[model samples]
Target: MRRIYQLALLIFSIGMLTACGDDDKPTPKPNPPVEEKEPMPDPISEFIWNGLDVYYLWEADVDALQLKSGTEEWKKYLNGYGSEYEELFESLLYIKPDANGSATVDRWSWFIYDWVEQENAFAGISKSFGYEYRLSKYSDSDGVYGYVTYVVPNSPAAEAGVKRGDIFVSVNETDLDVSNYRDLLYGNDSYDLGLADLDVENNIIIPNDNIVTISAIELTENPILLAKTLDINGTKVGYMAYNSFTGTDEFNLALNDSIGRLKNEGATELVLDLRYNGGGSTYTALILASMIDGNHVGEVFNKRKYNDMLQNYYTDKYGESFLEEYFTEKIENWDGEQLASINSLGLSRVFVLTSDWTASASELIINGLRPYMDVVLIGTQTHGKYTFSITVKDFLDNGEVNPKHKYAMQPIVGKSANAEDNTDYGDGFAPDYIREEWDYLGNIKPLGDPEEAFLKAALDVIAGNNPPVEDNMATRSGEQLETIFDSKELKPFGRNMYDDRIDSKFKDLTK
Candidate 1:
């Protein structure tokens, strides 16, 4: 009986072994489906959307973007545009056409694919023909002409002896009419300009025998064109034809040096020629303001107002004092120890020369100084840009700049007002004295010449002509938006409002 039980146990053990062996066989149940990992989300659009939402002055109107900020829906919406970031940015603008069908909103905002290049440009280092000019029609028979304003030192224009008063009768033998002038000058790298001298007596420009061909080249611009002291009615008047307020540490020193020279020369009054200055650094603007009058150091230089949302955000984060910018007397140099005092004129009043080109920081100087002293604007109405912009960029998780792409936006982040909190000159501040570029008969004169219309008008004012007989030129319309458009197309560096001292704060947020 014991032997029989043992045999039964062995048989049971064999059956269990066989069952285990069968489980290890190649007969397969359906393979468990491979688990797929979710794809990583792209952050480009999010970065752009968030940037505009925070810094754009007209952020409230961007309802489409704000609708789905942090959700997958926002990511999906951005991805729908693919990698066309420029298109995505343009769509976010607050735009509406006026009665003239011209889009008027957020015209100053622009995106740059290469931010490094943009930075170098605003610092007054760039490639160009280095000559700026204006296209105008003197008479129907005389035809359109290009008037050279000022040539950059060591530039192609300077090499070709292009002076401030030199005129171009035609480009490449073709008469420069308003219709084709932009195409001729702007769209080409090199062109032949039929040089002409102003026939002052005839009040017309006659073609010179010389035809100079100029090509574009890289140039580091010097903004101070003409700085001299004039003796008018025993009151030493300082005249400076400042092209742009390019605020660099080096540029600030240069500006201080210019003002210092004027001060040293015993200049009681100043005639700031901003006829072709289409705005630049606000830091430089403030420096000029301080140089004009340093007594207002502790007082408010200008008050900056951001969008309602950004304003509240800033006030919450940085206290209420963040909005006000006081006049700074000292400019600390690139080296921490290097410092220089602002060359303050310490005068009661100053005169500013303006044209259709005078805008941004130029207007800031005019508007900012109104409360403290007289800023008698001479020439036509300004370009009417009361808002300023900052350079917005992307970053990596490590706080360094993201190398994935080089994109930046110069969006209108805020509007600035003087100490009085007055910022209502959207149509531009009209000149106290209306002066014309061309005389009644039509002739463009040298910029710093005492006989020039704008400079002469300023000199007349300093000589106690309270209100010189206003010109019918006031009724004549000039290209008000030309400066802004030209900056975008011909010379991109022209449209700048970067403040070295203050703009660093915006950069900190990016980091």
Candidate 2:
């Protein structure tokens, strides 16, 4: 009876322990599966976004650029555009709204598909037929004709016997018109340019049987078109039809040599022809201005204003003096190698021959000299671009170009102000003597001819023979043709005033 009682008590104790353990323990649960997302596939878009965010002139005005990169929202926004990086870039530009509620989009900033081509163009090298022309519409008909403005020496066009002042009415047997001019002439790499002549009395373009077949080949253009001294009514006038401000070592030396030659010939005054000069390097512009007048070597030529971010950074780092570009007495190549002392004319007055095509660095010459001398303009209004751009490439941590893509950007990074703090020439600088080239189209003379309309006007002014600034179209019998386009506008470097110092300025910060 004692053993049975002990066994029952032990069994009851064990059951009590098991029940207590069961009450104390909790049940196990499986963890929810984790989500894995695919990574984004666009580094080009990221590059562009990052480049513009830091360097864009109007970054503050662009809301999309403010989004922190690498975040979910930033990734979403970028991925929404898919592969259309250009659309993404174009959307971020700060375009002001006009009075009519239309957007005055920024026309200066541009995208580059092939940075190699862009760099080549900066050096004044490109695949071209070696001739620039102006397309004009007949006053009475839809027919269009192109007049050769200038031809590159030893180029395909020059080899084919094309000359300045030659007219073309058709391309590849197709008559050029408003709708098909671009497609006909520019569409093909090679085409037969049908020659034409103007009938001033009938106000028509008569096609001729002569045909000049030309092809576009890679060519390097010498920007110094003509540099000569002219004897104008006992006044020794220097005339230079400078077409571009290519800041190459060769170009800089050539320019210095030209100016030295002019000075050697006893040039008392200067008549600078920039009718077709769209623009180029700011450094080259400074060099040219210094050569024109050496008195203000240390004076401020222009001041640059960047976006808020860059403005603050640069100001704090380099001070106000860093933003100012002064008149330099010495010439240097793009690589910062000292070339030579500037050959200054030391003239108190200068006459600039301008047109609607004269812009950027070309315009800079006018504004920079106005503070120091009398700048007399004798053509149509200037192109009116006070802004400048810098080439922004996708650079790796090693300071080399990003190897995955050839894309780049030429963004308007800053606005330039003269010593007077003036940047208000958006409507362009009006000519003191307005002489439209189209008005005397059929009667056009060679560029340096003393009888040429623009050069003659400058000469007349220098000779104290200030001819009346009247429209010559009334004197001519033909109806004044409307200029549809200028071939310079199609160039890769369109009125660009690029600063080569940008890379050096931002190098340390980027690294």
Candidate that scores best on TM-score: 2
Alpha-carbon error at 130 in model 1, in Å?
2.4
Q: How close is every model to the real structure, measured as TM-score?
A: 0.83, 0.89
Stretch of 10 with least lDDT, candidate 2:
502-511
Root-mean-square deviation per candidate: 7.6, 5.0
Residue by residue across 1-511, what tens digits does model 1's lDDT show?
A: 9999999999999988887795676666898999654332366666677778777888787765575555656656676667788777776777745578996677678878998998778777787887886666654443577666667777898898777656677888898776777777777889898988765454546788988889987678888987999898798999998988887888889999999999999999899998878788887898789999877887888888988877886788889888887788888654544568888989778888887778889889988989999888888888788889888778665667779889877778888899999998778889888876544323456667777777888888778776565654322334221221232245575544554444322433421
- Model 2, span 1-511: residue lDDT tens: 9999999999999988887796777677888888655356398888888888888888888888888877777888888888898888887788755578885546688888999999899889988999999998766678888898888879999999998888899998999999999998788999999998878786666788999999999889999988999998788899998999887878988999999999999999999999999999888888899999988889999899998878888888889898999988788765677879899999899999998899999998898888899999998889889988899998887889889889998888998888898888887899888788777766778888999888888888888886878546735643555579899987998887887677722434431
Best by lDDT: 2
Query: Where does candidate 2 clash, by residue pair?
Result: none
lDDT of each: 0.76, 0.86
For candidate 1, give the lDDT.
0.76
